[model samples]
Target: GEEVAQTPKHLVRGEGQKAKLYCAPIKGHSYVFWYQQVLKNEFKFLISFQNENVFDETGMPKERFSAKCLPNSPCSLEIQATKLEDSAVYFCASSQLGPTSIGYTFGSGTRLTVV
Candidate 1:
């Protein structure tokens, strides 16, 4: 069976520091997605990748967030110059090519806190 994995369930970083979160999508899947859920914000799409190329990144925060999907490696989201507002749960998800209406498989998420 396939599964998504996340590390360090919780993270606390000082303001202006860097925050890195990781995710392993299910094997055989090519589309990986990242999302952020803050205290008041609904789950918002952060980025999407097809294999090693970025498919969509419009939802990524312009100043501080970046993500990548490397070969044989889990995808990662890195936040530079973390801000207090950056505290949230970062989820990594994946989906097969069949249908967009179908839901995706998501990791438990890395809960990040910038203090």
Candidate 2:
């Protein structure tokens, strides 16, 4: 079976620092998506990339958040100047659905803690 891979299942960062999380979508999948889940909250879309191009990213935060999908490398999400409120579980998912549709297969997630 195929799976999405995520690193550092748990991360602890101090306020004002940075946190970088990694995710590898299943092979053969053409689209990758990132999501954020704050304590007991619904998963929030962060960004999406189809192949090497960004498909949609309307949900990304304006400050301190950035994401990328590099060739042959796992997609990454970096949060600079982390804040206590940034504590959350970040998830990565992948799909092959065409435009006009939203579908996904999810990873367990990377938990982030800012103190």
Candidate 3:
């Protein structure tokens, strides 16, 4: 089984502050993805990277949210001017053979709380 490593199990930020999350994809995985879960039934895809290049980011917000997955470095997701509504769990995932070939793994996630 594959595994993605996410750091900072929990984050607490004041309103208007910034929050950042870090993720390490599985050793052999080339595709990395970030998802936001604001509600139990909602999983919003934030961004995806194929190696160091961005693959799909249609679900990403035009501003305030950004992500990067670079070669030889941990991937990161950052949110600027955090709002109370931004409080949620951010999950990092990776697939060894792209999203379609299975072998996908999701990290436990970093729970963010905006106060």
Query: What local lDDT score does residue 76 receive in model 2, on the 0 to 100 scale?
Result: 93
lDDT of 3: 0.91
Please identify model 1 stretches exceeding 4 Å from their true place.
98-103
Ranking by TM-score: 3, 1, 2
Question: Ten-residue segment with the worst summed lDDT in candidate 3?
Answer: 96-105
lDDT of each: 0.87, 0.89, 0.91
Clash count list over all predictions: 0, 0, 0
Tens digit of per-residue lDDT, candidate 3, span 1-115? 3578998999999999989999999898899999999998899998899998999999888589999887889999999999899999999999978766777799999999999
Candidate 3: how many backbone clashes? 0
Candidate 3 accuracy as TM-score: 0.94
State the lDDT of candidate 2 residue by residue for 1-115, as single tens digits.
3999999799999999999999998888889989899957688988999988888989988688999998899999999999998999999999878533565788999999999
Model 1 agreement with the true structure over 1-115: per-residue lDDT tens digits: 3878888699999999999999888888788899899965689988898887898999998788888899988788999999999999988888777226365888998999999
Q: Clashing pairs in model 1?
A: none
